[model samples]
Target: MRSRIVVGVSPSLAGLQALRYAVKVARERGGTVDAVRVWLFRPLWRDTTATFERRVHLAEAELLIPHAFDAAMGGPPTGVKIEPVVLEGLTVQSLVEHAGDDADLLVVGGDRRGSHLLGSGPVTRYSVRHARCPIVVVPPPALAQRQPVDALLRELDREIR
Candidate 1:
């Protein structure tokens, strides 16, 4: 059977990396890719009525999947089958449910905000533990890691001078 690769999508750099990786693998394996994004109703979104707010959040999720594809691959990859899934629920749970047991692989972006000691963020960690399929966590490019520290050091030096 052709591989089914499910990858989580977010606005993070690592997220784009994971998406790109998933597309490449799908292309090579003659598989399909499910680019999934999960949306939740946060208590902080009290500015609008519940129903309308939920609709808006859902719409955002829909738009996000395409946006991620556009940003990652200049639009969806040419040869591979791409399915964009937007689910409303907890992030990790939604991803795991959509990926399911039969998926050949589940891919996620590592949490760059996490401390070096902790490795990945909570969602990535939870998915690795709970997901039935094998998982790959794509880390942010090294440039992403260095840019922040370099800026911070430059700022510190300026202050010292």
Candidate 2:
């Protein structure tokens, strides 16, 4: 009986854009929003903070998710709730698997360059293929519209030379 869209968000700017868009869409559709960010673990990795990383991740998620929820609600709270979920596993697989059975939809931000080589690469591809739910693959910004400062500097250097 839940009527909310689940958005997979991260601390990255791309993920932020997706989260913002999810709120907007939810507001228009008279629904609630759930924000989730997942961190994946590579197998056989040795790290000093591995034991403590989970706790730290949970804390960060608690702080950032609520803030995003509040920001999305805009003011005075319209009962549109934002639930933040922090999970660890295969990035996209964990997220898609953990998604509510009756969720309204699933929203995820996609990289413009299509980072299919990352650890979560296959996970992302699979989730998109078999989510069995409504999915919004937010298109990335145009490269021309977001040229890097380094590119500008290079041009200047070339001109000077």
Candidate 3:
């Protein structure tokens, strides 16, 4: 059986980096990549529209797979097999459950921008602490630049505008 490498997928820069790195690992290991997107229903009114909300989120998740793949690698890897999975639940729980204990690896993006800690985002931190398989956190390339404080502050100011 081919080794299973599961990766969390999102549209963010870190998310795309994770997806790209997952594909690289999969190719080297001759494994299939499971690009998983977890969606949740945050209903405003309550459970009355829960079903409809789930469907909408599910559809959005399904569409995200291709878009993420495209943004990450210009398109999915040609030789490696890509399995897109969309699940309904908490992001961390859903990813861990899907990855399972037997998975060869679980890859997640390292997002620390809004995180209280400078290490990893909640998903990455949670997966590292909870996942049965080994976890790989791909840091965003922007962090390598190490922009000066003034430049970073200016960028943040622009974003707020």
Q: Highest TM-score, which number?
A: 1
Please list the C-alpha lDDT of all candidates, in the order they appear: 0.86, 0.67, 0.87
How many clashes (backbone atoms < 3 Å, residues ≥3 apart in a chain or on different chains) does model 1 have?
0
- Taking all chains together, each candidate's TM-score versus the true structure is 0.87, 0.71, 0.83
Output the worst ten-in-a-row residue range by lDDT, candidate 2. 70-79
- Local accuracy of candidate 2 as per-residue lDDT tens digits, 65-139: 666555544432354666767777666687787664667788876665554435334545666776767777653
Tens digits of per-residue lDDT for model 3 on 67-118? Answer: 9998888887899999999898899889998998999999998873533344
- Candidates ranked by TM-score: 1, 3, 2
Residue pairs clashing in model 1 are: none
Candidate 1 vs candidate 2, lDDT winner: 1
Model 2 collision count:
0
Ranking by lDDT: 3, 1, 2
Model number with the top lDDT: 3
